[model samples]
Target: MANLDTALKDAMSIDGAIGVALVDYTSGMTLGVAGGTPEIDLTVAAAGNTDVVRAKMRTIEMLKLNDDIEDMLITLGGQYHIIRPLTGPTGKGLFLYLMLSKARSNLALARHQLRTIEEQLEL
Candidate 1:
């Protein structure tokens, strides 16, 4: 099983990965971070994405969807942001946030890779 540091390094190995973080949506705080460019402050980005996760979860509850969010995607001109709320007991209220370069990333593959990383993560 991979520990937090290993999981983060695994994420950075993904093609086009610009940054990755483990964030707590409940408190909008980051537990770990990796691979951010100088132009991107991963800590701040992770914190902001916390709101995105919380909002979606709230909407799901309000709508009585009887479902869980597997992932949330936000597309920008040059970037793709992926927020995947962790499902493991130790990961409740926490998520993996990934930022990829749109030009270089294969969205499907990145998602799949991230899922694999999540599965192996020991938290």
Candidate 2:
């Protein structure tokens, strides 16, 4: 298993990764972060995405979907945002948020890589 710093480092190594953060949706706090260009502020992005996660969870409960969120994707003109809620035993209210340059990333592969990172991440 990898510690938070190591996991963040691994995430940054992924192709097209612009920034990555481990966020706590319940409190809208960033537990750890790595990478970010002048164009992006990973802390702000992570906090804002907490709303997205909360809204989706509320919707699921209200609708009685009986489903769990695996991840949420937001695609922009130049980037792709991936929000994956951690499902491991110790990761109850946390998520992994990653931003990738659309032109440089392969969405499918990125998703796969993120999943692997999630599995290995030790919170």
Per-model root-mean-square deviation over C-alphas: 0.8, 0.8
User: Pairs clashing in candidate 1?
Assistant: none
Candidates in order have lDDT scores of 0.92, 0.93
What TM-score would you give candidate 1 relative to the actual structure? 0.97
Clashing pairs in 2: none
User: In candidate 2, how many Å is residue 61 off?
Assistant: 0.8
On lDDT, the leading prediction is 2
Runs of candidate 2 with Cα error greater than 4 angstroms are none
Please provide the root mean square deviation of candidate 2 (C-alpha atoms, Å). Answer: 0.8
lDDT of 2 by residue, 1-123 (tens): 988999899989989999999999989999999999887888899889999999999999999999989988999999999999998998999999999999999999999999999999886
